[model samples]
Target chain A: MKTLVLVEHGDGKVHDATLATVTAAGKLGSVAALVCGDGEEAAKAAAAAATVAGVDKVLLASGPAYAQMLAENVAALIVPLMDDYDALLCNASSNGKNVAPRVAALLDVMQLSDIISVEGDKTFTRPIYAGNAIATVESSDPKLVITVRGTAFAKAASEGGSAGVENVSGPGDQGLSSFGGCESVKSDRPELTSAKVIVSGGRALKDAETFKEVILPLADKLGAGVGASRAAVDAGYVPNDYQVGQTGKIVAPQVYIAVGISGAIQHLAGMKDSKTIIAINKDEDAPIFQVADIGLVGDLFKIVPELTGKL
Target chain B: MKILVAVKRVIDYNVKPRVKADGTGVDLANVKMSMNPFDEIAVEEAIRLREKGKAAEIVAVSIGPAKAQETLRTALAMGADRAILVETEDEVEPLAVAKILKAIADEEQPGLVLLGKQAISDDSNQTGQMLAALMGRPQGTFANAVEVEGDSVTVKREVDGGLETVKLTLPAVVTTDLRLNEPRYASLPNIMKAKSKPLSAKTPADYGVDTAPRLKTLKVSEPPVRQAGVKVADVDELVAKIKALGIA
Candidate 1:
């Protein structure tokens, strides 16, 4: 089996999500990574991808067109490269979800999205109905297009392989789309998908100020990524980036501590995959307890600070 | 400019789906149904655009069983000028649905196509992008905000890291995200008027698109349950439990 994994990167480095996809691809067959970017940063990303454990080869496509990582331009670049590979895989991040379907359509095939397990070379397991059900789906098409749920797979080593890098051409600046700009929250906290531990809050935090004063200190003490329930985000306590639910980011950290969260099923869909779950809520009967491994029923205001101080 | 919006019928988001005992699929018998939430956002965006005079006509389209007409009526009550239903009982996967939408777009000649980033049921998140590919047009997915002007549209999209903005030329495909706007309620008067508005029924065969499932489902089961651990008395015990998990 031949697998081509899309390399997701930022800040001149390969995101750990790529390592997870690379690991998933290794299960399928010989692994090759494709890094699409522009100029120097693209080279940096390619070099980083070349070192992912078990990545046998890295293909680099650099130009102004790829700088924005627009789906239109990126899909254009990948559709032409599908002639050689049996399967194309990428992390189910925003970029992957944005581009892979278009590639599948242009290739006249169907895509098996967000697969969690490899049932076989042609069959995979995925979540449906906001992750309420798991479906084992098999693709009959000649080529398989899949987006791996990074949280479901363990990441490969970041710096162990010595794959050779190959330069490829990019279809320069397709006038169909253009990158206007991007605004990512500048933070020292780890990215949500790859973080080892996460401290997430819910609407029970009440408002923005209370959320910051209560959740961040606890998160910082543990050096964990910060997440929030959809209620918190919808209530304007945090930006969309912080929301963890079916509609937002899905994280499977080693320890997920949910604060003041009622544990709506939608919120559980995002983090129930975490290995160990801890809940902090004033109400003992909150639905979050159904899935939480450890329950702490009390006021978060008093409990969080005490936990942060004790830690 | 004309706006074309695609909506879908899915289980109400509030319902906890029960997997069938036979493991064929989730049980959908006698469950409450509603329009996919993100598609409601799409229809809302289209109505706001028409209200702003950026669009002259709004057409809602859906591809599903006869029950989908109720979803189309919901769109009509939300201010769509008309709706078209591509009726089919056979499973219409994303690729086939995109083909049918492409045919509809071709016939309607709308300047814009709007779809929910994904349906709550299958959650494939593929139809809009596939339609864009088949139509050879630009696409903006997971859009939080959108602005239209002469010959171009600017969309601010929600991504993994944060928000990113992209500019697409007119006659483009855009998918709605949750934060786009709160969908307005269908007023009692609007519901009455929606019955008078034009609604057309067609089939996938009429558009020469095959509504066949390309992927086979081998099994469907409930997600593995995470058993609840013992509750702790205080922060000290909580920290001890976390530490016992071998997490630093």
Candidate 2:
């Protein structure tokens, strides 16, 4: 069975999660990386790097239609490619979450999302109930389209390898629906899924204004993505985009810092995979510390500044 | 334009769910159930669109056991014009549910289809996008806001970093996010009115859709229990302890 992995990129650089997906595809079958963008150099580089991991070749589809970072349009480009491959895989990032299902729907295939393990052709293991439970499911359909939880899988070896790069035309003129517009947020740190360090806030921070001043700078200083607990999001301290929980985004950063957050079960489901967890909460009994590698019992108001200054 | 919103009955979000001691599945025995939060948002958005004169009809649909009629009633009380209960006894995967919705969409011919981004129970986050795909139409997932004009719909979607707005042509699918709108409670009068609202029951067969499992569930296991926590006397002591562990 041949596997097709979708490569996501912005500006010109490929998303690290795509690299992770390539690594995962290696475990399944002969992998082919699909780079859809307007940059030839990046696509060539991506194809070359992916080939080293035993990928047969890299297919590039460059066009202005690929520029908007819209998943609906991207799915239109990918659905046609499904016929040539046995399985389709992508990183379970926001983009993948949006596009993968559409592809599955188009193919009339069943898909598994936020998947952690793939045992064979039909059986897969995934986290359900936010990370509180792991369920093993068997796909009844022959064609499987799945999104791999980026943090659960290991990145493929990129040492001294290159693959053949070929330009291919993806299906366009999907009579695509246009989006109203995009509101962009500036970030200096790496994307949330790729970040090595994460600084997460909880509702204890009082409000959004406080999170911006007290938590964001620390994440910036550490080059980490900012995360928010479910409570913080429910309290309106931050947008739901920043939520990390069973219902929100799952992350496994190298170092996860929980600030002023009382860890709830749903919140813990998303971040339990972090290599090292540091919990800073005034409540010593906060559930977050139960999973923390190191725990600090203190007011975030007093401790965050000290920690950021040190970082 | 007429819109159809699908909802699911799941374990209440506020309650901490526990796996059965027998390892059969989540301990649903005597558990409190509520409308999947996202679907509530979907229902709310549909009702708001109709109230604003953007939509002519707002129909709420649910697929589950007979008890799920309560969920549909809640939607009716909240403002749905009527309800469709696609009654089923067994658990249906998201794909199968989408197939059923596609059948309904074909018959009802709603210009717009809306659903909650993910149901809290399964957390699959698939139904809306999959339904859109099955219908061969454009889709917007994780939408925080939706506005309709003429034959096009503009959706504001929540992305990883921030938000993106997309304009989709009519006969599209859109999913709701937490911030889409604060769902209004069913007032006493509306609750009474919901009893009088038309709720039609249909079997999966009626929609020409099979409710059989497209995915087999092998097993469900509880998450590893969190270890107990330690208490420190003060902030200075906590800082000292954290630093000793090389975490702070």
Writing each residue's lDDT as its tens digit, candidate 2 over B69-168 gives 9999999999999999999999988888999999999999999999999987777888998998889888888987898989899998887767888888
Q: How close is candidate 2 to the true structure, as a TM-score?
A: 0.94
How big is the positional error of residue B20 in model 1, measured in Å on the Cα after superposition?
A: 0.8
- What fraction of the genuine interface contacts, i.e. the true contacts, does candidate 1 reproduce? 0.85
**Chain B TM-score, structure 2:** 0.97
Model number with the top TM-score: 1
In candidate 2, residue B52 scores what lDDT? 94
Give lDDT tens digits, candidate 1, residues B1-248.
99999999999988989999999998999999999999999999999999988999999999999999999999999999999999998779999999999999999999999999999998889999999999999999999999998899999999888899999998999999999999999999999999999999999999998777889999999888778878989889988887788775
Residue A269 local lDDT, model 1? 86
Cα TM-score per model: 0.98, 0.94
Which residue segments of model 2 deviate by more than 4 Å?
A: A39-52, A234-236, A309-311, B229-248
* Docking class of predicted structure 1: high
